[model samples]
Target: MIDRSQLQTVLESDFLERSFPVFNSPGIKDEDVMIHSLGCSVWNTLGHELGFMAVVEGPAPIASGNDIRSDSVWFDKADNTPLVLIEFERYDGTDRGYGKLEEKLGNLMEASMRWGDQPTLLVLSAWSPGLVSAPDFERLELMFRRGFSNSKGAKIPAPTNCQLLLHRLVLSESHTGLLQLQRMNFRWS
Candidate 1:
């Protein structure tokens, strides 16, 4: 089971305030900022706040293709067993965002095979206020439960050892600053 209190402490910490200033820095594209930088910041924060080693853009092989990429992977520094596999997106409530979620879920399923019986955290980090709305968040949760099918038209089993966390970055009105960091609980049954 996940320690909700510890998770809450990490989410409520100064990590976002300290790390998100990069988004406001001049010249970076707003659309690409989260994709390019947020993952690293979150990886570092999780390491500092929880003592886990987090790696960005880690390489992993997927069943469907050659080695696919992950936004970040978190694990114990000593043993190196994966504790989490994170995927980031800049969802604007569009079809593309939904498609991205589906693709990432598929990759996560393949990645979980390496962990054996240990549970791995499947985190989807994205923009907030957009996902804050109840209906939109619920829709994403539904898609998570109904994972993608394989080329054989057979449904791939969702990982029972996986726990999903939706980490939303709530930005300021200027769209260049972080207002808040929201952590919403999502799980696959």
Candidate 2:
């Protein structure tokens, strides 16, 4: 699997050049864009402030009974399409935690609506698994489908135009990380 530290470094650098603007609108002051440090929370480059609770910590599931924190970076499309919500799941677990994944997805859907008409793109990233099975992956895929449908059907506007993307990162035998991107889009009636 890819070294977690190396991946984290790349993400941090990418955020400043490509991901900081979505949350750092002109109306909001630079001080308002709180970024938490990598351990259990997100931080700005200076490592000074705590971001929105849900953005730093994954949304507390109304029912999942786990308030696990997630790593997310919010940014607007430079082309002005909408907001991009990126959630990174770099678990050291042998089996990827679908529960945490669902909770993060839930948070992204709720958070995106607050950004107005801007459509949201939720991306889930992860590392290679040591003990995950084909069945487990299948189950996670089905769960994601259900979550995507329900999130689209939320009381928000039907035409919010939200989309979902799964960015899978796997470490090969050569210790190089392979990137795979998959897309999912849904709209509620």
Candidate 3:
């Protein structure tokens, strides 16, 4: 089981305070640069929150039958055991579309399969204000409940022990200098 309160505490801390400034810096208009910078910020914040000493791009082929690559993987600071697998999806305000959301769901399913029965967290972090709406989130949640399938009808069952956390980062102009992080309650069972 996930310690929701602990995770909430970590998120509510000064993590965003230290992370979002990277975007406010000059010359961050490039989409790739913004994505990479946000990934790094998230990696650092997860390390601090989870006591992870190493956060690498991936432990590729996290499962035996598949070749999916996780965006980042966390390791324990002391023993170096895998702790979490993170997948990041960023949407520029212009492209608030469902295609990206479907792609992200596929990635999450792959990560969940790789995680198996481990206590590791599978984080699906989306940095888009448009993706944070209730209907959009519900649609994503439904995908998780239904599992993944190919166009030809082959199906992959969702992992039983894969605890998922959907972290949605909404950048609002109303909050002049703040990036709001909303944790959507997505049930895996």
Candidate 4:
């Protein structure tokens, strides 16, 4: 098992190189490609037959609820009006998070292109590595591990900007993992 520092480094690095495409075109059926891609059949990098991605509609916004929060995130309240909001879910109780993140990232990039303002806020919600042991955890954990160091002579302030939340739930035969997540809110000004 990788240590916390190594995991953080891997995740941070991936995030830095990662870019989300935002698409904003009139009459465009797939206004949100990444979001729509959820449950859509696609090919993985290794050329494997993928399953349908899951998509979630406008998630109910409520303050003070299980796995919920109200914060100025993932939107440009300064100039760009409320154009759109994207909420990701982790289906299969894995790191995939309702939909494939790659598509969502692509969609974010598309949105950025159409909109004049750069992303101001970012909000990411997903289970953590140590808790979920998700398939994606290895990647994120690798990122985090390599980026940050508990050893002597390490840099301060990691690359990624996000917060983690832990939710304790009853364990079952099928589900035996802690609920961990990281939320990021993106916006433009």
Please write out the lDDT profile of model 4 over residues 1-189, one tens digit for every residue: 112333234333433123211111111122234322421211111011111121233222332222222111233234433222232333245444533433333333233223332332222233222234333434433333234322233332222322222111111221323221222222211
Q: After superposition, how far is residue 8 of candidate 1 from its true place, in Å?
A: 3.0
TM-score of each: 0.72, 0.40, 0.69, 0.28
Candidate 4 achieves a global lDDT of 0.27
Consecutive 10-residue window with the lowest summed lDDT within model 2: 180-189
- In terms of lDDT, which candidate is stronger, 2 or 3? 3
lDDT of 2 by residue, 35-138 (tens): 11322232323122211113444332343223323355433323433244456554344334656565555555544544453534455554333323222444
Q: In model 3, where is the ten-residue run with the lowest total lDDT? A: 22-31
Residues 72-184, candidate 1: write the lDDT tens digits: 77777778877777777665656776666667766665565535525467776666443433225566566556665654564656667667676655444335543333344
Off by over 4 Å in 1: 1-4, 23-35, 61-64, 128-135, 150-155, 175-189
The better candidate by TM-score, 3 or 4, is 3
Q: Candidate 3 regions off by >4 Å?
A: 23-30, 62-66, 77-81, 92-96, 115-119, 129-135, 150-154, 173-189
Per-residue lDDT of 141 in model 4: 33
TM-score ranking, high to low: 1, 3, 2, 4
lDDT of 3 at 55: 57
lDDT per residue for candidate 3 within 43-90, as digits (tens), equals 656666666654556654444455666667776666656566667766
In Å, residue 128's CA in model 3 sits off its true spot by 2.0
- Backbone clash pairs for candidate 1 read none
Candidate scoring better on TM-score of 1 and 4: 1
